[model samples]
Target: MTSVPTVPFHDGQSIPQLGYGVWRVEDDVAADVVAQAIRAGYHHIDTAAIYGNEEGVGRAVAAAGVPREELFITTKVWNSAHGYDEALAALEESLGKLGTDYVDLWLIHWAKPTQGRYVDTWKALIEAQRQGKVRSIGVSNFPAEQLEEIIEATGVVPVIHQVETHPYWQQRELREVEERHGILHESWSPLGQGGELLEDPEITAIAEAHGATPAQVVIAWHLAKGFVVIPKSVTSERIVSNLAAADVELTEDEVARIDALDREDGRIGPDPATIEF
Candidate 1:
């Protein structure tokens, strides 16, 4: 098994820099798919209640034969669960679905700023962490302003901020804010969900220079920049190849070349500030 490298969170716990993400994966197929990821050397798994596959994921974990402590699991509460009480209840349901006593990381799936209850949801995450139901708490799709508001409101900084980021959308400013706050930046759609920029000549050239796949080069770029990256794939080959990216290293110049691919219009996901659900 390939030993993935880990990034240290402020809480002194470490997370595998590379992990598997199950976004649109179906509940029925999630177990087999997740089992494949485990066989591919991936130790971290990212799932969410919105994905509708936690039960399959739970079954896979129960049968994978790896000790629970040897794996890292993460799940998020959906938009409806935006208040403190709802967030806590949502976590319980997720735990029931995931068949795990606790998750390594639990996150507010989205700020859902329009609802104005993320701060309350964050408070629930804090309580869960304090009660040992979650080891760490974080948020997803949260912009810098929302991140700051929650931190200021609760005096608790989320250990991570998972967002839509790839070479084409590096999120430089958001990353800067996270760095200043000592929060880890976790990348979703890390390989460009639609294969955006995966075929760029610059990226291809870098791949050639490093004798690696374009996906590996892209994943390596995230790691070089100190971001936790989870690239989703149900295909067995792609799953293994994604984890193998931990072995690929990019030089400063190569990394810069990829960084230059960032564009103002590169965002592939919804704007966090305006999202209602």
Candidate 2:
């Protein structure tokens, strides 16, 4: 099995750089699929309340044969749960469903700037951490300003920021902001969510050169750029192959070639700045 590298968090903990994400996976099959991922050498699993698969993920974890301490589990509070109390309650509910006493990491699914309560939610996460219910806490889909707001309000920087990132939407500016604050950048759509990214001429050419699949090349690109990436798949072969991306080595120039694929209109997800939900 290929060894996945770990990224250090500002909180003194570390996370596997590569993880298995359950985004659109239905609850019915998530357990089996996640089990396959674990059997293929994935130590980190990312789930969220809105994904409706935490229970299945929990079941898989219980049956994985891998000890709880060896696997890194992450879940998030949804947008509906935006206030301080609601966020804490949300974490507790997630814990109950995950069948774990504490999650390795918990996050606010979105800033939901319209509600204007992420700061309070961040405080709630701080309280949860202090209570020993969570080992690390962070946010997803947060912009530079909101990241600053939460940190300013609580004096605790997020250890990681999960967002939509790929070769096309590289998030250069926001990544710079996160880098300045010692926050790790995590890519939610590292393979572009099964879109044209895998079919791009540049990606295919690079994949051929490395004798790898397009998805592997893309995952390798994310790893080379130092962004924590979670690529989701229900197929067992793809799950194993994606993890094999750890073996695909890319030169600095190749990484730059992928970087040049970034464009002004490359964003496929909602803009975090104006997203209400």
Candidate 3:
């Protein structure tokens, strides 16, 4: 299997470009699904306490027999656990559930500005990284203003910023801000949360040109743009097909054609700024 290139973090670490996201996957089925993803060549697995499938992921990780160092594991501290001590405790709990001593990447889940404690939680993450409890630290769903606030308050730029990104909602301006800070951008809904991007005429045309699936074309677009994408799927065939995207190369013009699909107002998820928690 071809390996996807890794993007460096602010802390001088690297993360695989293509990963497996276990979001919305039920606990009962998460282990088998994750095992399939691993068998399909996914080395990076993204999960969180809020997902409620950490134990299953742990089982799969152990069962896969892939050495711990060979896999990149990431999890987040949920919004309800936003204070310093609470965040620390939540990390311990997550570690327990995932059957790991330290996570490769730990994130602040959400800005949770309404809670007014993300700064405190970020401080805890910094300490956790220093203690080697986490190899890297970052934030998710952080807007530019909130991200700046975190940097100014903690004097630590996030290693990466995970956000809802797809062709329709490319987040170009926010990505520019992240680039200014030398932070990698990781896309959560890399496929538009199961929307029609995979079935769009433009995507289909590109896929037909490459003799690949529309999903492969979409994943190729993300890879070409240098964004880390964690696409989720429980189906064995889809998992294999998604990983096979690493081999599908898109020409610059083809990428440009896909970029034209971006819309100024095409977000498929809730705005992080307005989310209550």
Q: Point to the candidate with the largest lDDT.
A: 2
Compute the lDDT for candidate 3.
Answer: 0.92
- State the lDDT of candidate 2 residue by residue for 159-276, as single tens digits: 9999999999999999999989999999998888556999999999999999999999999999999999999999989999999999999988889999999989988889988985
Output the better candidate (1/2) by lDDT. 2
The sequence of per-residue lDDT tens digits that candidate 1 reaches over residues 83-167 is 9999999999999999999999999999988899989999999999999999999999997899999999999999999999998
Pairs with steric clashes in candidate 1: none
Taking every candidate in turn, the Cα RMSD to the unseen true structure, in Å, is 0.9, 0.8, 0.9
**Candidate 3 local lDDT, residue 198:** 83
Q: Clash pairs of candidate 2?
A: none
State the TM-score for model 3.
0.98
Residue-pair clash count for candidate 2: 0
Question: Model 3 off-target regions past 4 Å?
Answer: none
Give candidate 2's TM-score: 0.99
Tell me the lDDT of model 1 at 233: 88
What residue runs in model 2 are displaced by over 4 Å at the alpha carbon? none
